[model samples]
Target: MPQPRSHDIRRGRYSEAGRSYLLTTVTHQRRSLFHDFHHARLVIQQLRRCELERSCRSLAWVVMPDHVHWLIELKALPLGEVMRRFKARSSLALHRAGVPSQRVWQAGYHDRALRREEDVLHVARYIVANPVRAGLVRSVREYSHWDAVWL
Candidate 1:
């Protein structure tokens, strides 16, 4: 049997308002475009912009070299729409900032909706600790591109 395409895999996925989700998306070809501080900030700007627009409430986020992990509580929009807006806006921001990548993000993102019984704080910590786990910093505090509400 053949494997499902990315979109196909998400066909049955549903989004619920007021639910928290952990989202991950990669840069085109995993090019590490975010290694540049300014470029990374552009992406972060978009994340904040999305929140201000009330698409979702950002709980935690980390901008890695080639990817991003975001924990958010869905607001008015569905998960797919929220991610769509974020990726599109961030890609435009990267272009305006003079980044070379025409496609700032891959076609789709991965999302896991948090269950009520889950420890949200634990998940937030895991998201912010990505840089430490990746060896980019000796400690999470040493990394500058991550944020969490609990911190």
Candidate 2:
């Protein structure tokens, strides 16, 4: 089988401290059912554990049916450590829930660092609005599986 093409972001480059990122990850095979509101709640809980353990700051996040977008500020740990723990814990939770699969996430995730001049809050709003734009909800507030510190 052919290998998947890599995205533009450099992996493991942000292994140092003090980098903020907008990260995204999708379910394997684009399986929406794996990320329903209930499952997403569990995943969010796991993410919280990761944030607390790694001491990262979560600015915004939204969990869609098959994917998630997170805006976070790295504090004490490297960005890679945060993502690894988040993905690992969420996968374990899904497996415990009887997902009946070998994998829950794609091989890698996408991340982009925010420039100092950019509006971080605006970026967060865009992340939270994904459900509305996808027609899953009439308004972002109506979505049950998203949250942001600014909201």
Question: Which predicted model would earn the best TM-score?
Answer: 1
For model 1, how does the per-residue alpha-carbon lDDT over 1-151 read when each residue is reduced to its tens digit? 9853788758878999999999999988899999999989999999999899998999999999999999999999989999999999899888888987578888888989999999999999999989999999999889899998886
Model 2: per-residue Cα lDDT over 36-116, one tens digit each: 556888889976886777668888998888888998888787776788788898988888877776788886788888987
Q: For model 1, what is the alpha-carbon lDDT of residue 96?
A: 85
**Model 1 misplacement above 4 A:** 1-4
**lDDT of each candidate versus the true structure:** 0.92, 0.81
Deviation from native of the Cα of residue 88 in model 2, angstroms: 0.7
At residue 49, what lDDT does model 1 achieve?
92
Give the lDDT of residue 84 in candidate 2.
77
Question: Where does candidate 2 have its weakest 10-residue lDDT segment?
Answer: 7-16
